[model samples]
Target: MSRNVREAVWSPDREQIRNMKMYRLMEKNGIADYDEFFQRSVGDAAWFWEEVTKDLGLEWFRPYRQVLDRSDGAPWPKWFVEGKINAAHNCLDRFVKDPRARNRLAVIWEGDDGEVRKRTYRELWTEVNAFARGLKQLGVGRGDRIAIYLPMVVENVVAMLAAARIGAIFTPCFSGYGAEAVATRLKDCKAKVLVTADGFLRRGKTIPMKEEADKAADLSPCVEKVVVVRRLNRKDCPLNEERDIDWDVLMSNRKALSAEATDADTPFMIIYTSGTTGRPKGTVHIHSGFPVKAAFDAGYSMDVGVGDTLFWMTDMGWMMGPWMVFGSLMNGATMVLFEGTPDYPEPDRVWMIVDTHGVTHLGVSPTAIRALMKFGDRWLEGHDLDTLRVFGSTGEPWNPEPWSWLFEKVGKKKVPIWNYSGGTEISGGILSSNLMKPIVPCSFNGPMPGMDADVVDEEGHPVRGEVGELVVRQPWVGMTRGFWEDPGRYENTYWSRWPNLWVHGDWVQVDDEGYWFITGRSDDTLKIAGKRLGPAEVESILVDHPSVVEAATIGVPDPDKGEAAVCFTVLKPGVAGDENLKRELVTSVAEKMGKALKPKEIHFVSDLPKTRNGKILRRAIKAAYTGKDAGDLSSLENPGAVEAVQQSSAN
Candidate 1:
């Protein structure tokens, strides 16, 4: 075993006091061993989930008479049957009721202009109550959808909690999304109100979010009002009085209002996931068990506890946004919200925030780490990162180079690297690394405490030591109720493949030691001359080359090979992207996987098309290379990336 792996096995971090409840409860039950836990959790799912819900402290108005109501088939299984409790209540009310939590910091906002703002539990309650009153004034009621298109400022967090506080369903669009993308989500949810900002600062430049809001409003006729927060101090931003209201004025005279609890199964948010083949799907999450599960996972798996300042580089539009908000705050941990680009002013801006806030747990994407890796280790060598205990990564598969760099430099090789995997539908991580387990590079220790996850072959049989589809055998508290107004689509998308199991659309594998490795999306799996290959495996091999900075792989049609692997790569500085370099990359892949999986073509490019949340858009790359219309260019961080790839391919 490697030195890091040996150390992780010999000595794992002990769980803090506030984080040990779930493990203790699990031990109280028959899940004393990890192997036995995995077996029983998947084989006897109903009993596993029933015990989980209670151990996690999920609130329900009426107790679920049964753990699951699968009479309607797995596609439409009813979890927490006939239960009623508001998610906002579980996140906010419970925290406020704890006398020790009243004075603890709930959120800490750090602006790009070097301004810092802190809000305690008492203060956050007032802000949420006032914003909830404002939402009520805009005629938002139970089950109504409220679209939030704001920066990662304090107002954005307040808007989501406020909407949920009053039983309204909140849907957040990433501030980086363009008008059409925002319009599609708002129209799909039939949003009644939009909370936006006049503009926001990014890399010291003013971005006009209100303009996009106006264009989205023009497209979405269901939008009744737009609440605008003053972020950039814009004087002449366009505004419609009949439909647009100043956010500050809306909360000026509003008094603190009590939360109105709703049914446990009532929709809390409509999070849209960019589907591989179609437009984004609005996955609807509910009130009852999501908060408890998020909090429990953050505490137990990530080791976040009271007084710890946590910061995950994410926006409200992504799952990590809601995950950070409920997870950290519910455990009485202060959350650090950053409102600008991570590399603003300098490449070390994120490191500065960590040092400034004494942030204990830092969550970010692998893309961010890759970008920083290009700058060398000196950028973080002199910084004081002693406050950090754990580092979290998500969004995409991480390369061992960047993953190890994060551990050695930022963590001093002591802190645990908590690699988590799941989608917006699962609310938080279904498979995550726990504090008590050894964390290998780019691998999960195991499934979360209650999740019944497995790597299954095409025949629905368990597979060990080989890549297969990742599926959940049982339902958990945080699973999405269904896609909004698209029950048929949801059924066909998730449930049709594996009979009662929820196929999570990821290609995963389990080693003999039982550690899980995710190999990109299952839909992105390519059959090169009838042999299955995962894009992540090829990409990981490419990234291992010292000359390569980043890489993305996709399958393009080939008359001879049926479907051939095509790789696009961005080289490190001073590394020539010539014919010899291309041949070297192909040779590397051939040696790593096999000659059968060798790429037919290797195209050098400046960048890859990725979402604002840092997920590479593999479908866009496939469509671009195949001459198919690249659908929905709205979620891309660099729309020009596709054009660049096309130009390079032609050359």
Candidate 2:
């Protein structure tokens, strides 16, 4: 299969032809061009969003009379106020009623042990209904919070939908999170029920998730029951007869449950963002408009249609899970869910899943691509990837080498790389590259259909050719209502920078061609000798070096300079990290971004600390280097990365 895929790799020109077809589709859909859409989006934000929501077939119990109510100011802009709808209805019920979709595949789960599980929309609806009934039997109700601590299995998805079905706000904790992290979110949300699995497989090893849930339950007084799904047959799994319930037993006795009728503004989910400076903020997304916006962006921007199978490398804990599930299902598309590391068994495990399932749209992170690129094209030599139509990237800025490699090798340059940017607060992408736009490495084409995004200077004036903070001028459907139980914090965090505009915290620049480049986080901007520099600009130059696999730059306090640049780098596999390679990397950054922005210290590390969603935590690195406590290490995929950095700092 790998050989077949290698042979089918088309030249650059052939790839261009494929992209042209995607552009034609956009034109057919009334977006004359990417630029036209961008102009209309900023000029007529409300109208543009209304059109997108309607086109996505979002059915509201009470349709919105107005698209937005911004008279209250940007900080308090009310969206779809008069509308009433349920997110679960938009994601599941709609598909259940459609005959063609009823028999169509909803989720294709691939276990780490090579076991495959399939669920059709009809079957998925039944399971979700039963789960909802079980929650009700346990005294869970609307406005209540349910914490889910499970792996990437079908049950996790079912638990989420079931919670939404009954108007219970769901909060998912990454199965990899330790007991402390899980307990923090549980206490914050006052979760009444905790959903977990007995165990799960990771890299062919068993992880006892139920034990972690048990520990969390011990600390959280709000938890009334622990629902455990039997994933691995552990002989001595612990269970309390009073509070623990077997997942199968509960579902077997419950009947199909009806969807709860709720207001559009009702809280749907609380997704915690990896807060590097303090406690992780529980970003609250609501029902109705949030699902509609996700569906619209995935369908129109990524060109996902009914019959297409979408697969994104993500876990149940991340916002991408909700984004992928709701967007694909609401659009009547199938989703491929994998329950193991991308490079588990072999370097080509992801490609195998793609070919085996005939996945059409595959979303991944830049970190994953960088890792795959190090393995070279040989890993993907012969896989049948003709089914793939679009490639999506999110989480962080991608370098040109990995981007071009992904385009030329995996996509054969035929698929458009949809670069997306948004946080868990928004539920989905605010800015993204559309199929019709010209391809650029690590750049977004424009904002989503309705988003009014702009790159502005510190004084709030628009900047076209220089790097500045990214802000949205108007409110959109998927914007978060507030932080869970912390409306004051939400106001101060998001809306404080600009009066009503949302300061996205991303430092970005838009070229004269209108191609948007994200430099890094606004907080990561370094002031070296009074000159401001973004970490992404420096990291991009470092990654351009052949020996460098990935790099992260952070500003550390300096005696001479107000802040000096410190770079942490990871070399390609088999390449040893040495002083010579570090010198080359530092020199390369000086040549690209200027000597003033060059790193004062370049240290080699095995890996950089990152969230599960694949964002490098620069603030964490800064804290470690400055001999300060690293806050909120909960979302880190590799906790060892922090110790590695600390060891390097001591040296």
Candidate 3:
């Protein structure tokens, strides 16, 4: 298993090659070549999506008059044209109809304090219904909006499904957000109601949220009601008799509410993903859009079928949170929701969850893998993680060292790491690793089915073996309708680069074998002299050094060269980064990526600033280093990290 998974360890077992939905669909369509099948899928995306839903056995109240209606435009391609559907019905009601589905577990949640909660499909259905009735009682009807700010608890899922059940647009706010961050989203969406918790445990400490919610509600005049879930059973939790209500009081009756048959284009949730500056852009996903895409990616890429357990280390605010829930349940599979940091109480917490519950599919990030690798493989020694048939990765581009470590140590080189790269706007994945394929380290086999993704030069011409912008030439079912209340901005952001293609802002390369590797965000590309390379390319080489735990490379303005690459690295706990070690890190990058692409300066820092979801904030890092404004840093988990980088740069 320790052998390199890039080449030697790609002998997939017979079970791995079995007919899944995509394979069967291709075979049925008389498409023999996988590549040609993808081309045909792009050629007739509408037919392909209709076929996909049919294969998934999805039901709709009113069948679509047209498979797709691009009458509006490509940027706003309407899917399931003139169709009627409800996301919650497909996820909950359909599953609850079958006794086998209802009896199976839907979600298994674990808190940092050893508190565990499990809900079967039947139980989840009842709870969602009860919550829906509660919302109805509170006058939350169709077209109304609600905001949810809670920890990774079962109630969060219930609230989301309830909102979707009643056709109310809901946004899952990151529980760690400050009052301003929460209020901005609430104000933008004009959320009428907010579902939150008193507080949740983190690192054995209670992080209060009631006060923050109270402050945010005050700031957002549109919010009329605030429902507080009494987590930890805090009797003295903050309460506003005029506006705030208890969770139990709201969900008192085990009443049932009928799922609203919403128009296929009805926006179900508004997920706010912060940009480099300005207010966070709320990516509006619809009833049939995000869910279908998520389920398709999970089912096709990881083979997450009924009875399998899927766990993605993510937050409710992040795309993967909703992705895992809708994807797994729609596939009739169970989802694992664990709250708290993966290494807080124990380094083996992630493995423990997989072992305790039979997690057939496990999704993680490269940052998490790098951090875990620092603790050595001893923590993973005694755990039996045989249930992990497939590994999933997202969030950021992977460095080869951590990628190899994950394949070797956790997977034992037996399972494929299903690397997926996409965003909240896309709902699922643009480029994803498939079950029936060979995997090169830190690379994707190709674009996911139904996606006509390609690497294009600045002029929109396809480039081979050279880094370029990742673009989608054809429309897909899961593409975001548009940014909330800013269709013009959405058009400018995605479609303006090319006539109709979606410029995804990612820098990618396609090898001769057609394996795609996402280098980093295109905006994060470093132009050192004449060579254009991504920061991840330089950072990956830096992280390969023994002392470097993780690295963030940024392109700083230079005197001779227009811009030069500079690295800010955090060393392993036991390792020190002296001048000699810094020189070694620089030399390693030079040796790996050629001397022309070498960094102008290499600074060792105590920490690298990152979002709560573990993405390195290069913009924040460059801002702090350059003494420039770091705009809209509410998404940042640690302010101290930025200051540490600034101090290191000064030194």
Candidate 4:
């Protein structure tokens, strides 16, 4: 265990950094050091993005005269003004002309049922063109909304690229989302076409995706056409004769169509946030904005290239899914798509996939590492992960335990674990670890080159060593224009708190060394006896105990102190939730966090409620314990865990 805990520095060679696109661009512009170069880039973002776009050779039909048009306001800034380009052309069409990339595998997908599918660049081009024509045939024109509800299958990628090909906006719903959640996004966007699959396998069972799609379509009156794929030849596949059509039948014997020419700022997608409270906000992204932003993150931040096969464990609905797919393809890199849960069949599936596929870059969540660590290091030692070059993670804050496990067990203490922190509003990462920088255990080295990210108190004053709200001082290319319909809600959610500054919900701390650490969401920070602490600090200590599998801490009301910390824990499979064991766990936390910071009550449950993408929902547990409504359980992958928590807290 001690071997797993140490700081690692993975610095690239001077020649390697010199060959990178960012470094070459910086050299061309006479910039030398990373800090000075980044300062100049954000100091004048218009010129920086313009240079990067041209450096990356983004194919455009018509170019723009001006770089940025901030006529409206900073919040509504327009990027690459008057430029005409299609995201599909930049991602697929341009690759077709290059012989090296034309036949390379664009996507490699694996299903839970041992089914594997592969597509090359040429093949992906044909399918995307055919699907774009199919969408046109179904009356989907430019600016039309198309919603896709499918698993991580090839069709999911096809649907997204096809929608962007024809200049239509697409919304992707999580496969695990219930009907109401699906209905809300589709209805809000007023989707004209819905692409869904009959079913997909999950935990050795089939989930009727088409059935849920049907339920959502029934509630969404704007849906004019339903396209269903035959994932499972089940007898009960829903068929609406009037509006529904077969996916394979529509694409049979059809010729590929030409790509659409669209303005750079044309609307591309409307993704909803998986927030714990209230209705999910619909964030609007543009073609030039998100694709360009994602490409920058991949090329510069993650150092992914054509020779790399990048795989990030994500679903179609989350922001990272679209971010990875579009970013990897635009860079002419191969992408790996898994259609099953990571821990199904066995716990070492993550390591197995890297070994089998020879993936060069991998991304996962800290929540997943914590769950996998409980199965022991033997599972990790079974596979050879020498192929992995870079390790990346997001979704939640990392604990030293799981972060160390990932660094030592799988990464062999050699690969750099780049910690990225961002949200759906920003297309990619705001804070990221660069190849040139030495990574701390669980810290972001600095803000990504183009973002003016900072930590500030309630008064909007800069602070160090103390937790504060994370904010972006300047607008970037990928900042969402606004919410779907309600400008007031969008403004209130982000800009209302501070003047001209975008208020990110997370609370972060910048240590004396200038390394940034996000505590958690500001709302989730526990304030006990006037001393505030991030739940991650408490949960990290609890998860360090060998018997604990996962933990979530929240501040509940108390008579003596203003608030008291209460922890909900999920034990290992064989570990019993006896009083003796509970007492020892409480004492352990006290020894680590001091007596005042110790949890007032400790409850053990069979599991912790988390989203399909594996984000522990502390707010949901608190709501369930206090008899408040758990708002919007659409992203809840395991409602049974919430029920377990409720029952245990009551006892």
Candidate 5:
């Protein structure tokens, strides 16, 4: 085992271990060993999920006849068979029954310019019911699609629940997506209504969201009605009298709409995730599937519970937004939504929010941490974050330096950072840090309980102590039903690689100590001189230098080698990108990763293109540098970064 894997940075004490939901579940089931319980979870999905839902106190209008039915296949397995449930009912209605729970804070929101908003469970339920009635007044019904295109606000969550309450499917587009990108999703789902804001604040600037919503609605002829949130109250806010309605006007009806009793397999959400070579693929998530699984992961893995606050810096379009919402609400914990960049106004904005909100479980991306780390530890000095118990990280692989910085500085070497890995299609994490297990820097304890995950060679055989393909051998409750209107594409994307095995596109490594590390996306892997390389591996080496803030590596066409590695780096402020520094970085990688894997060249730029959730757009970077088509840039948070990359290539 490597030195990092051998040395565990964090471990749970007896009290911490006893308090964990996973440990309690094991004890309740008479299982003394965690590894044994994990094996049984995968060995018997039915028993495991039954115990989990029972533990969650899940109530069903109609009880499930069976736990799982895989007669069709692994990809199409039906969970909680014959059960009738509603997502909004579980998320809101059940909590309202208890007088104490009803008044507890459920959603805490922060705007770009430091404005704050808080909604109790009762208040959130009231808004949801009103919006449900509004959606019904517009003639929306079960299975009807609603496209939500708005910033991170309380209204976005309201729109989602209201759609679910009425049995309508809602798809969220990134708040920063352009008109064309928004229109594409509207067209694909043939949405009946669009929920948007007039405008919202971002970095102290007013973004006219209604203008893009209007343009997108113009292109999507299927959109029959548009609901405007009047967030900015702009005087020039255009409205089509025939099809547009103001949110306050529509919500004039304060009556509650009865929740529909949807079957377990009934689809409630269709989240569209962008692929490398095609239009976004809509991943279908069901009532019982996503909510139940996400809640389980949050409670069992992260140890979230009642009265706790869980905050993830994310947008509604990203999977983590919904993941945070469902997980926190279902677990009776408060969820925090932020509408601006973590570093906006000041470098300490994120830490300030956590301290102000009393956040117990905080989630952030490595890229965001790397950016904040440049501001140094001074920004974090004044914040009192004693309430923080754990940190959640996702979106991309972590570099050890940033991981250590977050662990040592922000966490005060007390809180553990849970490295979470999953995709939109999976609903929640395939791999996550368990509170019961010791944490290695930037390494997952193992697969999330019941994942049945393994690292495998090309022939589907298991491999350890080396990097290989990440695969899951069994279907869990959270697997996507299929891509919307594209079952063939879904099967081809995941299942065609191996029989009854899901080839999750991430390249992973399992050390001898059983700690797991995600390298990067398999599609993003670079091959130089017949050797495979994960960009994160090279990026980690480059970022180890004090001058480099971030780095991305890509393979380009080569005459001798099959492909050669080309690197782009974003430097710390005022650092000179001289030839000497470039040579130093090259030698650093060559010494650590060996000479054959050395980067052919390195270009320093102002920024790296990233999604709203802070995942580096390495594909876009490669495309811009090589003069190729950069497919599906709608998820990009900064389009100018791509232009900067192109300019660098020219220079």
Candidate 6:
């Protein structure tokens, strides 16, 4: 642990604390202490979630008889039992009911070629209703699955809301995925319909997405219809007369449809997250479960509310993409959906979007920051980001250098970077930074409200001041109901670890000051010379080198030490990756992390495999280097990187 990160750099003033929604929630509960508020939230979850739903103004056709039902078991505890609610209603109908909110912008979309589109709550409601009616016309209804494979656009959001409007479960595939990946999800969900765009632009090139969608639809025999959104307006766009239907034609009926009066526990989404070894796990989310948790985290923790524009650089498939949608709309905030890379056209595109959209809360991945930082601060010159109030980060652990650069340079040391950490199963964040407290660099101040999170040893005993497994003791509202049609795997994956304990698979530590930091995935832990190690520790030290832009570390089998560390690095542009540079990098990590943890080998690569959301695929890299089967690579944004790692090992 770095001593420099021990002291908090940013603290909320009296005025700032008073303005925070977290403070208001605490005040409303008559709790003077923030810590006390968290205690009550986890100690009495039923009371806390009841207040959360009431505070969020979540609409319910029939109120829940109880806040939580745990008789089944800890892993499968039902939330908001007996309540009739609709996700679309909470996101749109409630806002449209108020005249003042009806005219507010619900979604602001920016295309790759400088095209812009905006929709108010009333306008979005009309579009969503039209699509919902169209889905109903296709015989889609409650319990049916609709697969969405479209770029980041207003229509993607509309499709999601439309599916929810009719009580259909929707599964979103990464826009960058190929046919096999998309087909896997479609087949797993056994979707009745597939929504996709003709194509999309990226880095001045038109990617033919329809072809992939067509191939995937062909593979997924259960797909009864294909709805194509004419994004690029291609005259040559092929349409299978038997199965494909134009989006506009499908929406010929512009009549409105009522939001489905769904039971709160009814599954609305089946989001698949890639696992280390099998097919992707389909994490099931419900109407009140994901929406409520996302709303509370955004509204209370991130301080998003009416008039705040929230933009996260992500694809529709990732949890954060859906999280941004439900969280922002549910809070009456505008969601900014951009359809291009952050560095495309210019490295400043991300900053430009923030300035152009008046974004108050901006979220990004640490990998993106590391990639953007290579361009220097010249890209951020003219954009006046005066409207940005908070910076949100997730996806992976942050190295100190990029974290400091984001805080000190981009934020001008004024805005707080809330390091948010969680999985798709958690709906939002397990650990999040609170505006009411001071923040340490790259560290979460505490767990999100109602998360009974703790760091535990191998035996399940709580451990502090050292790295350990991150576990949640009590069931939270956002917990995934279970893996779709695979309850046994879900139970074995999380609950079987230690009775009712949910082992989240991440290595975490709480320092003496009570600040939390995730080291890396517990399964990816590098055991060297009888010492437990985290890949982030080695990667952080390697990235500190000026020549190295990004790095990934993994443990390989060793005859003597049991396991040895191997490093893969992507050097800065124009930097040579000769043996001398590799030696220097190896020495640098050795000097910083002691000689025992020195990388046995360092290989230079152009890029590392990552998810659409920009999380480095360390397990994939290890699998490739070891010539092991890399299972379920559907989430990888760059399959070519795997071959590169494999080639490097052969060298």
- Candidate 5, residues 562-592, lDDT tens digits: the string is 8888999999999999999999999988988
Q: After superposition, which runs of candidate 5 have C-alpha atoms over 4 Å from their true positions?
A: 1-6
Residue 254 of model 4 has an lDDT of 53
For model 3, the stretches where C-alpha displacement exceeds 4 angstroms are 1-8
Give per-model TM-scores. 0.95, 0.94, 0.98, 0.97, 0.98, 0.99
Model 5, poorest ten-residue lDDT window? 1-10
Model 6 alpha-carbon miss at residue 51, Å = 0.5
- Order of the predicted models by TM-score, top scorer first: 6, 5, 3, 4, 1, 2
Off by over 4 Å in 1: 1-21, 27-32, 37-67
lDDT tens string, model 4, 392-482? 8998888888887888777877888988889789999899887776788888887998899888987999988888889999879888989
lDDT of 3 by residue, 486-578 (tens): 988889888887898899999998877777888889878888887778888788777777778889999999888889988998888878778
Look at candidate 4 and tell me the lDDT of residue 351: 82
lDDT against the true structure, per candidate, is 0.82, 0.82, 0.88, 0.86, 0.91, 0.92
Cα deviation of 303 in candidate 1 (Å)?
A: 2.2
* TM-score, predicted candidate 2 vs. hidden true structure: 0.94
Evaluate model 1: give its lDDT: 0.82
Model 6 earns a TM-score of 0.99
In candidate 5, position 313 carries an lDDT of 91
Candidate 6 residues 105-155, lDDT tens each? 999999999899999999999999999999999999999999999999999
Candidate 6, residue 536: Cα displacement in angstroms equals 0.6
What TM-score number comes out for model 4?
0.97
Candidate 4 — which residues are off by over 4 angstroms? 1-16
